[model samples]
Target: MTMKAKYQSVLDLGESLNIQNGSVTEENGVLKVKGTANTPYEKNILWDKIKEIGGESPSDILANITVADESVYHRHTVKSGETLGKIAKHYYGNAAKYQDIFKANSDILKNPDLIHPDQELIIPNL
Candidate 1:
């Protein structure tokens, strides 16, 4: 497959993430991609997808993904029935990290167990 076609999913994901200043090109046998992700989490996910398809340290692709926001890992919008533990698990892979999330959002979150839909929480860098 052509290099561009091989990494099409990564391009689709970048589009879905609304990556800014995105560009994709294939030169010789290598694919080149450049974009700015809104948050570190988005950039990380893009890299993860690239690795998943190309293997760790694959030489087939070169991606230049930048993060627009580095203050926090990500900004999560709470949904119905979502708890701090669930949110923490999704971001940090550990439900026990809920306390960290709670602390980062302490200004708006009076209690860790009391989050409502539409509330934006900062998924702090751990």
Candidate 2:
């Protein structure tokens, strides 16, 4: 398969993420992908997808993913029945890190135990 076709899923993901200034091109046997992700989390996911398809250090693809926002790891919108622990676990793999999230969002979160849907919380860089 052509390198472009081989990495089509990565391109589709970039599109779904609404990556800015995205471009894709294939030269010879190598695929070139460039884009700006809104957050570090987005950029990391893109790289994860690339590695998943291409292996740890595949030479078949070259991705240049930049993050527009480095101040925070991600901006998470609270969902129903979701707690800070769950969000922390989703992002940091440790539910105990909920305190960190609560601290980062102290301006909006008065209590770590109390959170509502539709609240925008900053998942700070650990």
| Candidate 2 lDDT tens digits, 9-112 | 99999999999999998898999999899999999888989999999998999888899999999999999999999999999999999999999999999999
Going through the candidates in the order shown, the clash numbers are: 0, 0
- Compared with the true structure, model 2 gives a TM-score of 0.97
lDDT of all the models against the reference?
Answer: 0.95, 0.95
Pairs with steric clashes in candidate 2:
none
**Runs with alpha carbons beyond 4 Å of true place in candidate 2:** none
- lDDT (tens digit, per residue) of candidate 1 on 13-99: 999999999999889899999999999999999999999999999899999999999999999999999999999899889999999
Model 2 alpha-carbon miss at residue 57, Å: 0.2
